[model samples]
Target: MKNPKPTRQRERHNVYRRVREKIIGLDFSPGSAISENELAAALGVSRTPVREAMLLLTEEGLVEVFAKIGTFVSRVDPEQVAEAQFLREAVELASLRSLSTPLDEEKVDRLRDNLRRQKETGEDIRSFFALDEEFHRGLMDLAGHESSWSTVSAAKSHLDRARMLGIRKIPELGRLTEEHHAIFDAAVSGDAATAERHLRSHLRLVFADVKAVEEDSPELFVRDRDAGPHRRSAFVWD
Candidate 1:
């Protein structure tokens, strides 16, 4: 039996993490082609590892490959974003309800801390978004549903670009902050129903904003006309 050392795993993990972050952070925008040769050269690694990393990203739905053309970052799909939002709400609500007790002082403090940073980082969309993600994941972690965070995180990748547009134009940042506070208070008081209600409302606002952007920026979103019947089912959202 060949035993894999921890360092080898860590190196591979770092490679994949960096590449995935670059893609999700919009360092590589949607439909932007990437060359494995260039990426491997830049990362100072062999094509073998970079190829593996690209494959992992593809599995996460962040990249698409064309047989003869090339590999490009996948485009955003409004319908998929809607579906992701639904799944996120269901998973998170279920997770919150299953919690036996209110969130601990540490978790509550962490959430408050994150919120403070979010407010102070006004107009810094990337930083604010990163903090926002941390806050929600922290809440889910408090509810002992860390694994669900992975699913939500993966789904949110498809929603990010649209969200970036929404966040830029939406003036509801303060309201959003208040919503977070409300959810935190409910969770701290062990009020599952209240927490779930606030959570759903918060997510609904995001969905509305994303839908608006999708309507306004048709080119950025997947179009019904361009999609086949089979693909249309996956791209149509109510």
Candidate 2:
């Protein structure tokens, strides 16, 4: 005998995560249509849970619903991306500063292990991206502020989507991995100042990549802060 409430909640969350990943990974792409019926069929559930999941996404600013135009994957907002990046830097730099001169041996080893795995990922964008996230979150955990990672992650959905688009077009993974190594080296060497400098530079560089991406695909992003949903065809927008 299964409890219906838990099962329903689980199904709703399953749809939410799956759809969220697709949106962030650019599989759905910005301004693309999201068919509730299609997603329900694909996820092997009815429209009830799918609709529930979409309602939540709407609150996250990841989904947009029009009166007659239907729902769509929201466009990447550069302003939102910058705001998220600022929050991420402030939190992560604070964590680095709070770390003791001599870091925990176990945490240092784990950081090194994450870097090694990052190098091994080699062109697997999603895998590398996941590791990149884990590595940053690990830094917070190492500094005794693990719970703060959740707050940072919640605020970074827009930034994450922008990052996926940037990395997909730019061959920056190697450079990014090298930067991670540099940051980790400074952290373990007990040089908080150097570590903060490296991390600030690393976090700031994503905007450069994002700008290049925007230049290439103007339609995928919103330039003006007061912009609203512009209409387009059913299958594509231009």
Candidate 3:
């Protein structure tokens, strides 16, 4: 028997993308409640699709639904952010190591172009993050590990919010561009080990910067110091 395609599924996906962008851009800030009715109205869609999209986002850990309180953007957990960074570094370094001598020129150019766009974007954090993802994905593609790139991309969402906050305060635009240039040079020179090392260091450095922001901006963070030792553990990274 041929199964019928679900028409609303496409609409749900569109809604999800729109809402997810808002969440990542911090338009829907952490712990901010959003009503399904209001969202549907704003998106010019029915409630069914909005609900479906919200459910999908909730599964992705991007949104939280409280029974009585309503749905809200999930707060960034520092521990989750650290774990995501660890996963990204592990996959990225492994992919880099697998690359032999004589790196691909096309991939190198792609990364260079991404960095150029990143620099030209200036303080536009959303555009910068998109280019940053593309830059890393280009390296992963060069290593012939598209699936690995997908895995790392999925894990990076938690780190995205933290990164957005960190970059806003720290002005990492120039530093990030320099780091990418360094990694690009190492990769194109066929220095796999050096490239992997630089990539790992870059991930760790960003994590440290994010942690600093969490400490400095307590109000922006959802975790409260008065919440006890659990909160401390959440923020502490190995």
Candidate 4:
């Protein structure tokens, strides 16, 4: 019989990424119970791999396990979101500072193209989110800080979720797109001070969004542990 090691490893990795994406994308819904048996069946894998993936997610603070209660997709933690926002802003602002006069025409054109695409996305929240990511990564690349963006992306899962929540609350993403344009304009003009200011303000906007969302849907966020357990039904909106 062929060794099952390679197959098992591949299954574990697939399950890990799939589960992580669902949680980060809010597919599973925050604070919702995650059933190991159901997930295993859905993935057509044994419980071992699913359980292993859950363990890794728990370590990442994306999932929580309560003794005898069950495993759950962890609620959005504003503190964690704030920390990610701070790191992202620092790195992006520093990147902006690295830019020199006479920005590359090719790179500037690329950013403009990205903005055009962002406008075309209209009210498609998921599409807008994807383009939003591409636009930021494009800026990092323009500033010769492409490698740093990977680090930022990996650490900003919480921030991404919060941004999504914000999108849901807001009427449209036009303001965010305009903010991107302002930052891009400053960068292309080689105005480091102006660029840094715009970028700083843009990055910090997530906190206000978080506050609005938390006030609207308090159940979707993490509450104090001492307050005791309260499991609210997960509500998924299209």
Best by lDDT: 2
| Candidate whose TM-score is highest | 2
Candidate 4: count the clashes: 0
Better by lDDT, candidate 4 or 2: 2
Error of 3 at 179 (Å): 0.7
- Candidate 3, residues 102-184, lDDT tens digits: the string is 66777778888887887798877777778888888898888888778887776777788888888888776878878987887
Which portions of model 3 miss their true places by more than 4 Å?
A: 1-8, 224-238
Q: Which is the winner by lDDT between candidate 1 and candidate 4?
A: 4
Candidate 1 lDDT, tens digit per residue, 25-95?
66666666777777777777787887887788887888776565666677787767877888888888888
Q: Give the per-residue lDDT digits (tens) of candidate 2, residues 1-238.
A: 2446544588899999988878887777788777777778877899999999999899888988776667788888888888988899999999999998556788778888999999999899999999999899889888988789988897888889888889998766989999999998898888999999999999989777877787788778876656665555344211
Question: Model 4, 67-184: lDDT tens per residue?
Answer: 7677888888888888888889889888899987666788889899999998888899988888899999989988888889988987877778888888888855999999999998
Considering only N, C-alpha and C atoms within 3 Å, which residue pairs clash in candidate 2?
Answer: none
TM-score of each: 0.84, 0.86, 0.85, 0.83
The reply for model 4, stretches above 4 Å from the true place, is 1-10, 67-69, 101-107, 226-238
lDDT of prediction 3: 0.79
Q: What is the descending TM-score order?
A: 2, 3, 1, 4
Model 1 clashing residue pairs (backbone): none
Candidate 3, residue 173: how far the Cα is off, in Å: 1.0
